[model samples]
Structure formats: structure tokens, C-alpha cells
Target: MMQINSNPILAFLVTLIFISIPLSALAAKHNNATEKLSLNQDDIHGLWIEKRKKKLAVWIEDCGNALCGRIYWMKKPLDKKGQPKLDPHNPDTKLRNRPRCGMKILSGFVKNKENHWQEGKIYNPNNGSTYSSKIELSKSGILKVRGFIGLSLFGKTLKWERPEQKLQHCG
Candidate 1:
């Protein structure tokens, strides 16, 4: 008859190694998911259009130490009078005559620790309303723009996509 030698210390060590292997694998998987969410901040610098309403194209670019976005083009730049659309809803009557196509609707977007553009403002020409905004680039290559009244919970997120073809900027 053969007798098997049993060591408590060896058994415990083997058990711990087996447990740690799965835990380490789980951690690696989590890290990879996090890496996919962490995108380059510079990737935001380009033209993006609203996914739902393709009426406007906003061009995001480096402005000073932060980022700013301007209205690069419009599907219908002219008003019924055949004149360039103006900001009639602007609070300042004197500034209402300004064209909407070249307006800077997004400003002061600073990249934060979470790889999102935060502490920015987005202007809505439709109502001449400015809201606190933040932007995030999703893993699916969608530019998510959130405009909030006060806090983020009271906000709406709009998806903007990078156009595959060339755009007629301001044309």
C-alpha cells in the first residue's frame, strides 16, 4: 500500500495561488474596459454633427488653453428673406443681427481627470439659451454632449457623430 504525504502549508499555498489567478484575470479585464473609455483628449478637435438632427455642424478646436466649438455650417443658412439666419432670440438686441453660421456656440471646455471635456458652455441659438455643458467621447466613436441647467442630473445628452464625407463649411 502507498501512503500519501499531506502538508497543510503546501495545500494552503496552492489554494491561494488558484484563487489569485482568477482575481488577477478579472482585474485585467476590468483594466481593459477602462482603457477603452479613456480616449485621447485631442480626438475632440474636429467637426461633429448631431446624430438626430443633421442641420448643423460644429467645429471643435483648440482655443487658448482650452477648447471651443463654432458653427461651421448649416443645412439651411438662409432665412425666408434669403438673408443669412440671425440670432433673433439673442438677449442683446444689438447683437441679434450677427450670423449664426460662424457663431461660437461652445467655449471654455477644459479636459478633466475623467477624460471628459468639462466646465464648458453651450449656446442654443434656437432659444438663445446658454447651458453648462460637458462632453465625453464614447467607445463607439460618438461625441456625447450634455447640456445642463444647474446640475448634470437635470441635463440632456446629445450624440454627435463625425461625418464620413467632406462638409461644405458655412456654405
Candidate 2:
């Protein structure tokens, strides 16, 4: 057996090679994970439906420099009068008469970092409430949406699924 002190330079080089191998591997793994988490414009540009209530479907599309989602369809489109549903709960009386379909419910969302969309607001037609929202896309094709009153800790999280691409239309 050779003594390490007898050839210090060779021993150091061998140790460095072993250390660099794992470091390089770790760096590569981090890069791949970041890439997988990153979101692209097209990744979210489609119809997404609430995982719980299949009644709501939103069409996400590019709007200006950000992304917006519009209520394209509803399971129950007609009201008591057999007329298309209106946003009666809307705070603005002027908009109350407007149909719910084709109404933009998600707005002002811009990609902030990989896999995240921030600085957005989500309107809840069910209660006529709006809240600050952020969205994160998962590798499993689910959009995790968080709606908060003020702080995120006081918010609700809901999962929306990207259904099979279909010719979705608003009623």
C-alpha cells in the first residue's frame, strides 16, 4: 500500500475528482427540476375545469401581457326564466345584467417564476366575491389556485384539472 503523504499531489487530485462527481450530479438534478417546474405560455392556455364541481369551466388565454380566464360554459346555463344566467350578484348593477358566460373571472396573472403565476385576482361568481390569487402548475397537469382575503394564510386552495382537449364552448 502506498502512503498518501508520500504523494500528496496525487492524493489531492483523486479526492477532488470524487468530490466533483457528486457536485456535478447534484447541479444537474437541480437544473432538471427547475426546468420541469417552469411554465410556458402554451402550458396553461386551454380549458381547465374545477376538480370538484364539473359545473364550471374556464378558458385560459393570453390577454395583453398576462393571462386571463373566461367562464366559457356552465352545467346549468338557464335561470328560472329560462334565460341565460346573469351576474346578479355582481356589485356593479351595470354588470348584473351581463351574462355570466364569457365573463372573465381570472385576470392580471403574469408568470413570476418557474411554475408560478402571481399578481392576480379571481372572481367567485357563486358569492360575487373577489380575492387575491396565485396559481401554480404541477407536473401532473393540475393547477393549484389559492384565493386569499388579505394574507395567503387566510386563503383557500382549490385544484383545477386540465381536461382532455375538447371543442369547449360557452353557453
The candidate that achieves the highest TM-score relative to the unseen native structure: 1
- Per-residue C-alpha lDDT of model 2 across residues 1-171, encoded as one tens digit per residue: 887778999889889999999999999999966654443323887778888887888888999999999998787888888998888888887888888899999999999987799999999877789999999987777888899988989999988876544535756
Tell me how far the alpha carbon of residue 32 in candidate 1 is from the true structure, in angstroms, after superposition: 26
TM-score of each: 0.74, 0.72
Predicted candidate 1, C-alpha RMSD: 12.7
lDDT by candidate, in order shown = 0.86, 0.84
How many clashing residue pairs, candidate 2? Answer: 1
Error of 1 at 66 (Å): 1.1
Residue pairs clashing in model 1 are none
Q: Pull out the clashing pairs in model 2.
A: 72-170
What tens-digit string does per-residue lDDT give for candidate 1 at 1-58? 4222377777778889999999999999889656544432337887898889898889
